[model samples]
Target: MHMSVANVVIIFSIFSSAEPYSGQPHIVFFVVDDLGWNDVGYHNSYIKTPTIDMLAKSGVRLNNYYVASHCVPSRNMLISGRHVIDIGLQHGEIGYYPRGLPLDEFTIADKLKEIGYATHLIGKWHCGCYSNHSLPHNRGFDTFFGYLGSSDDHYTHIIMSNGLADLRLNDECVGYKYFGDYSTIMYANEAKNIIAQHDENKPLFLMLAFSAVHKPIQVPDVYMQYYKSTIHDNERRTYAGMASCVDEAIANITEALENKGMLKNSVIVLTTDNGGGSVGNNWPLRGRKNSHWEGGVRGVAFVYSDLLPMDVRGTENSELMHITDWFPTLVKLGGGNPCERKNLYGVDQWEMIRGMEPSARGEVLIALDTTRKASEEYRTGPFKYDKFDITTFAAIKMGKWKLLTGDSTYRNFWDMPDPEYGVIDDEDFDDTRMVRLYDLVDDPSERTDVSEERQDIVHEMLAKLDGYEKAAVPPQMQTKPRLDNHVLECMGPWID
Candidate 1:
């Protein structure tokens, strides 16, 4: 059945105390799929995101934010506040039931609901997408009204693997569910409905993780036309349209909250799981979705609430943050201290959001993989140490000196020519992924290497990395049954 993609506003609001920062307010999170640091309007990208731009303009922009280099690890880390190895998925591949985030691990929803908040998940629940056993309904969420896997066919809602429907409401198995509904629009409507029907007496936590700009980049025609003129490549244009749709959905969600007078107390978290993928724009950064380069982990992030100190509003924050930080921060915001738990790897940064401290976070443990044998990375202050399985990609940085021990794929990573646009030469393909060093501050483009000139700094940075590599979590070798190509393609690559 085809349904008009209209803005369906459900007029129910969970009545809450209007007082500013009174206890817990509504929490709406929009974690878009594969949205790059340079994708949004606020980043001066051609892609139009008036809503996102306005949100950044009115909210706090996290200029130095980061996420995992890919989806599965990012989502797992974000939800569990545990590193992938501790959670049993070291690399960014693995999304299915049983293999998903372990039930034992506490989630943000679990924390919020414990403190009298009604939690709901209304989009891609990629953490796990199998039987009802591992779905959001079984998780901390009071309600789950989205897909079980990653990117579903936006219109058909088909998971495409096993060629079955992927859409769901609560827990019933999807069978061509919500036919003809543009997923971006459908997800937005669902979010608005949840906001309306929410019991305002308790705070609301809605995780609206949109499958925007993800692969199989399907978007509605009306949306596609909006970006055709600006985006040249047909594939990229389609991707841009999808991103545009997600931006619109965010705007509508905020509007619905505003209409109910819930915007005042709501703290809306806007971010993406990882860097841009296939058609995503990560220009000026090094690599794409899969690489651990800054392009993959640096995400477009922000937090907005009317209650946020007005002075900090629209201002850029330099405090380093990770996707996992939100888990503890939101818990603290809900009047509970998640960081108090010894098991959690996340720290509470609610004070940073309040502009009370310059940074509670000192270093970032981005990833430690034993997947393709053993490569890890840690970012402390201005320095980032990256040790990759491939000898050609090892790197360490301190201040302006970036020491790369392998052939750096800085330029050739995004070498694929778009379908609409013809091929381009590989600028970074110097035949060998060899040792190269570049000062990021001076050459944000990563075009030069000064490894020999800064041998002293390289030695110190390598020594610092020696400690991190030794302490890095080893990859877990647990494996589970595989699903159809369609299903596993989007989820994390499973390992047993």
Candidate 2:
């Protein structure tokens, strides 16, 4: 069913009446890139982040939030209340959907706009390209100010705003220059300007997606100097500095809100697109981004609202929530109902945020694959069930019992394969790999394999995993490998 442009506008206007705001609560979604679990001050990092720490202290911290192991998929889940697989986005396919989000699908931004909120998206929009029919403007946002492609040099930024190209600087598109050494600073400035000049009569929904601390490793002199003397490794030092810059930007945003007297009436949510990058420390977790391990998918998340009261502040929630939950959560908060036409995988977390009952949501399914092969895991309650042999499909963490299917063929912090499991040490760290399980409650680091001792539990979890795969949307055909390369080339060279 295709609606005319005029019809779309009318429908949007009608939805806006659903949430009659004498002054509807505003939303500021601050999404960072490639941030680790313990990289910020609240997470016990050596780096200083006074701003983010304050947000955590004054808000609610989510201890068990999860996202896809990669960026585009996670963002897809975030915008649409469905798993990445359900939308034909899996295994880090950049620009997979050339078209923007489907028109039939409803988004948090769309729901907010229905209620008279002015929706805006600024910064990295990796969800799709500008030519795609689902650009930010078409997806219900009133405005868009950011780059269509992913990862660019901070010094020379390439941005697309409101479906236009080569945006003007002082009435001229040429000689346009980006101001800051970091993209975080530029995004922060745009957000501040938008907030300051916004019509106070209408509530706002600003999606501030920062492309900081992702790659190409760039940082300001002040931040670099501050971290060089404090952090140990060169790579970690660069990452820490970049993260600090994001914290500073958040400070500027909240301060602007408070000055406008909108802090109490606003909902601020802070989270990363996915897990940490190569140089990150997942800490007590198991794997890095792109892996099925807890470290790769688990992320740091928090929410702050003055309407909720102070005694409820700084509460830690261990509910099982994922990126897909955001769409439903936001829609409900903005006084808009979720579209009931199709099944949505996400559950609204508003009740959880209100310090209500523990999350009834259960069992997150994760899949990883190369061009020709695939592997999957089902995490329910405290157990993880795998498909391949314990060795061919290694690294299962069920509470304290962590099983290594085989030795570490990958170079990671935890080395040494269990000899008792018939997994020997090969030069590349890949041995015949047997299914060896350990009781993690006793050996938290996965040093032993107790699979032989606890056959009943292992079998039960395996059955559960089997059921999840049968119910999940089947995997899609892998797209061409160089799609991301082509996108980068089209965007041209990064300035800095």
Candidate 3:
């Protein structure tokens, strides 16, 4: 159920200092890159994700969770609790741009560290690593053992785009030692080591952002063999193996937590950075990554914690949630005042997750890409102007209505390669509508458009978009750096 913006004023009760575990639970947040909505066993897909499915069944499933359409934008929001437009990163992913997330904004790790939590980050740090100042080690993580780039070759730990080693231990490059080790296993081993060496007294905040199921589909032969008989297509089978490896990594990490006696008070979360990629499947959800559709922004996520009330455990939460909400939610769970700082787009969803009240959030700005330009002139419905020419790609959800303007990059109904789940596109499918509206409450798959019938809602949402646009900042511009000898060999910060 969706709440109106007017209903968002409901006040939240701060957890008392006298609460259990001193009200600061250990947080284990796992971010899986481009995990498909239907890839997990719980979603009834052919992919094997036993650990993820079991944990989800024993926890709270986030049915209406949303994130950005791509990597950098979602990571930016998740870290800062701020929208991408406000931070000038709404355009696209950061490549060799030599730009990072604005350092001025306090990260989730920074906030938790203020309250005595030991923050650790393992795996992908794609928010940017162009400069020493923007590295994860400087961004409030006490320890960072991971890659600094978007993706890498699973075994070699080398970014194929630039052919540079990407693994690091804190600020030092350590890729040479991990050669030939599959990233999923390597990162899991790192997580286990951290847990084993952790101080039991302090609350631990661990963010395991895996680079699995993203690109360069590579997995160990053992993992690949598990899916060989069931998954016929080679690419699909390899993708399944990668996902399965992630599941195994999670299982290993969970076992370590249990062994450390930290599982009892830990809040373990699983979320995708974005929707599935090409080889991945987000069946019946309307589009893939890099689009403004539900399949692109809606995440596959869940929260597993012993702190949740018994009755609410293993239930589905349909309340609206965005990637930004985690910043404040985790801070609150760590016994810190999430309201101490102001202007965060995220709300404290701890209460909502605990099954106490409805979601405090009423609206979600799915995406706003001012950089998106029309490839050709197009018009449809009552929009008389050159809507495509003037419009910026944007989508917003308020209550039951979701509005879209400008170009939606990829618009297709994608399914698994398996013949059973394949969808046949109808002849009437229109991909040219520059302006579209859907009642997401009634049409979660985004099958029909109601823009013509609901001009009043369209105008209201357009005004909202205008307000956001006026307040939005331009994307940061940075020159591409020359690949010197040192830069070509290592993927650490190139700038001081």
lDDT of 3 by residue, 1-496 (tens): 1122222212101111112455578999999999989888899557777778877877799999999888999998999899988888887567777666898888999999999999999989888887888999899999999898888998999988778888999877899999998888888888999999998778999999998988999888788898777887777789888988898888778777766878777898999989987787887687888888888988999998878887777799999999999999999878787656458889989899989999998889998777775544664446644322325788999988898887654656656446244554534756566778999889988878898899888878877887887788898774565335354688876666
Ten residues in sequence with the least summed lDDT for candidate 3: 9-18
Q: Mind giving the per-residue lDDT tens digits that candidate 1 earns over 1-496?
A: 1222232222112222234667677899888989876788777557677777777877799977778878888998898777675676665454443467776677888888888889898878777654445667777898887776766777777766555566777756553557888878888998888888876667888999887778778887777797766767677788878887887888778777877777777898988898887578776576778766677877889987867887787799877777788888888878876854546767788789879886666556566553443223312212333343334234443444555543345434532222244324456455343345566668765556565577566556656545655655554434665555554322323333
Candidate 1 off by > 4 Å: 1-19, 95-98, 129-133, 373-439, 455-474, 478-496
User: Could you tell me every candidate's TM-score relative to the true structure?
Assistant: 0.83, 0.77, 0.91
**TM-score leader:** 3
Alpha-carbon shift of residue 466 in model 3 (angstroms):
1.0
Model 2 per-residue lDDT tens digits across residues 1-496: 1123343334323332232223468889988887777667887657577778767866789877777767877887788787655665654455433433445677778778887889988876666543434566667777777766556666656433212232212212321455343577877888889999887667889998888878867777677776766665676677788887887788777767655756657888998877676766566555567665556667889987765555567788777777788888888787887666767778888787768766747545444222222233322222334453332332333443444443333423331121112212223322333344556446544445466678776665455444544554544444453234433423322221
Q: Highest lDDT: which candidate? A: 3
RMSD of 2: 10.3
Candidate 2: C-alpha lDDT: 0.63
* Reference-based lDDT, residue 338, model 2: 66
User: Given candidate 2, what's the lDDT at residue 433?
Assistant: 38
Error of 2 at 367 (Å): 3.3
